[model samples]
Target: MFFKSSKINEFRLWGLLFTLFGMGLMILGTSGIVFWGQAGKWFAGVFMVIGMIAMLLSVGVYFWAGMLSTSAVILICPECNRHTKILGKTDRCMYCKTKLTLDPNEATDLDEGITEKA
Candidate 1:
């Protein structure tokens, strides 16, 4: 299924995944694999560095996404009657994928999100 959420939500998800991946790498580095035994200290240090980089990237992404969210507009979806955040004038409902727009004149039924009553 397609991702059903606001753009900001998508960005946050990616950042969170990055954080989890970093955590995984850190765990692997410290897991004490036999091959790493020869230079375990150096190996662990490298892994820790890589993991920290990933974690830092995640934090930056999260901060940027959150900052962008501050400018997003929250609108109530007509289809689902739910509050949805819209960025850059056009967006879909987070719950129902209903296409919405800041420009009312631009709304049309040809799109998937907007359903016209027959």
Candidate 2:
């Protein structure tokens, strides 16, 4: 609840984290030359490979998120009146973080006390 985010946004956030981590690794790899002279080439190569793998994984995550976004149901949030996308039966508003659900049963349950408002 403290870190609520729409499913799509969560995916994007993870992708971004992966990208940043990969870039960091690549930079660290390149810096190996400054630390170990000629021997650093092997260390750099290994880190660079790992970095590339992370970058590729990020690309895949982004692609998956994009595909999911295309199919997500867009709805207007009752609390903020802003448009938000819902990925499943339950999700939070992208802007207001209001608890949302497509199921009527869940709605009542949320209304009882579990719902989160902006």
Pick the TM-score winner: 2
Best by lDDT: 2
- Give the per-residue lDDT of model 2 (tens digit) for 22-76: 9999999989988999999998999899999999999999999999999999999
TM-score of 1: 0.78
What lDDT score belongs to each candidate, Candidate 1 first?
A: 0.83, 0.90
Write model 1 residue lDDT over 14-40, tens digit each, in one string.
899999999998888886545667677
Off by over 4 Å in 1: 1-4, 33-35, 104-106, 110-118
- TM-score of each candidate? 0.78, 0.89
- Count clashing pairs, candidate 1: 0
Kindly report which residue pairs in candidate 1 clash with one another.
none
